[model samples]
Target: MIDLLKAKKLIFLLVIVISSFLIITGCGRDSGADIQSAEDNSFIMNTLVQMRAHGENAEIAVEESMDRIREIEYLMSRTLEASEVSQINDNPGEFIEISEETQKVIAESLYFAELSSGKFDPSIGPIVDLWGIGTEEARVPSQAEIEEVLEFVDYNNLEIEDNRARVTKEGVKIDLGGIAKGYAADEVREIVKKHDVPSAFINIGGNVLVVGNNVDGSKWRIGIQDPRRGRGNVMAIVESKDQTIVTSGDYERYFEEDGEHYHHIFDPESGYPARTGLLSVTIITDLSLDADALSTIAYVKGLEAGMKFVEDIADVDAMFITEELDVHLSSGLTGIVEITGPDFNLIEGENFAD
Candidate 1:
């Protein structure tokens, strides 16, 4: 598991600001007359893990959920040398037997890899490690260096045989950083619900999943961070109940050199940061796993195609923040999604598509 005070996540800087990326807003009053609530946070899975729940068993529910997240980090975190993911990545082309939990997330990763046709791939580790965007060694590699690693970035090359998994190609590897947290969030939800907690707020590195309404009996109001602005500063507020709200943007993990900015989210085809002309893409959905992967796909697809891609999915909505700071809303969130960023212009995404 990701040990406390050390991580591969983009949060050490965020460590000071805690709520830098996403903020839980508008909690009215205390826990009320007779309600029990528990809230706590820790650094794990390369990001800060925050949990809050209400009910008689809120404390136990939240604690169990946090423990589950730790278990996931132990198994899935790529930086952990003994982790299942590392084992698979370290010995490419060899079927490394993984835990059911590891296999489950990897299989789902393949689903998204196929779903987006490799735009969002689990095999993006080679390029990710080469750039090292979020680490102290972060640097821009030469095109030849990028091209050399590109051959190993194909999701199609990954093969899963039941409980065992392996990258078919020798140079290929798997990194679940993109989708693991969401899976963990979904797992946390189950833990919370099983304990009979009526409400909870799970913030795994600003990727939020809220269960039930606020204590005040109103919808949970969440603030979406302004990608360029500092943390804890929000551009919009979303009212969510029993749903996951997450974003994938260039601002997450990045480095700047010679006036050029490079972020962690990569374009599988380009082998570099996605130049999708999008500042950030936020997905609001019932499943955090879906929202997490969808946000990345939409961001990599760029604004126009990304909007259309998300619109086709039923019961899911997306908010596309373009390079121009223009807020484009999917059909479902058109009239909704309150704008809180003064410099942001809320316009019809359809018109922007034109």
Candidate 2:
């Protein structure tokens, strides 16, 4: 599991102050609460600050949210020794009986695979292991080797019957690195809401889920990072209320060898880093899991087709940053999204506001 304080520190710079408002969630709350009177309580959990404010019971809410996140890590994390997911990967083809919570996440993952037409597959562990971006042994695997492993990378081979999940393939593994954080963020949001936190931001790594409207009830102005720049340099900002923002990029985790650039996002079919013209894809939605899944799906689908995918999903918006340093906003996100900074050239699509 990630050290909570250290993880929070890495992602804290991503938050930019737009406006202030109290975000409310959880069970107990006074009928009348003042924004100035609300308390901001924070704790380290699942690699980020699980924070919330309830003019009422602030401390307990923060604790509960953090606790839930820790429990989730036990279910979904690969780093944890006793994690159900880790156990499944350790002993492939063995039926791993999972908790109801684990079952639900697996179901959701399968659903996302179907929705994105396998572009957002969860059975990507073969490709992930080959690249080994998070390990010291990261390298560009040969095309022949990648293709050999691709045979075991199909989601249809993942069997979920009743409370048990079995990998039919002999060597395939499952990694939820992209979607689990968003699900955790959503869970934290629900927990705080149950405790009556008026408004808050639960950011697990770079995945952010808004607790409520800002303290003033306007919206949170989230700055989208410039992939080519250092910390705090933003290409654009979006106005959001009770929403989640998730971005997947080549630059997030990657290795360069000779003249070839290899990144974490992989194409299951090709078993190589996706050749998406976009350097990154940022997804905005009410659900963090959806945001996380789509951020990855868009990167795999490339700029043109990915934009259309966002359009197909109702109430979902996205920003695509191409290798050319151009930014493209989904039609539904155009009016509400703003571009800033000097390095990016903003282009409008004919269907930008569709």
Top candidate on lDDT is: 1
Q: Pick the candidate with the highest TM-score.
A: 1
lDDT of 1: 0.85
- CA lDDT, every prediction? 0.85, 0.74
The parts of candidate 2 lying over 4 Å away from their true place are: 1-54, 352-354
lDDT of 2 by residue, 78-144 (tens): 6677988777777777888988877878888899899888887788988898788755688877879
Q: Look at candidate 2 and tell me the lDDT of residue 315.
A: 89
Q: What's each prediction's TM-score?
A: 0.93, 0.85
Where is model 1 poorest over a 10-residue stretch in terms of lDDT?
A: 1-10
Please estimate how well model 2 matches the true structure, expressed as its whole-model Cα lDDT.
0.74
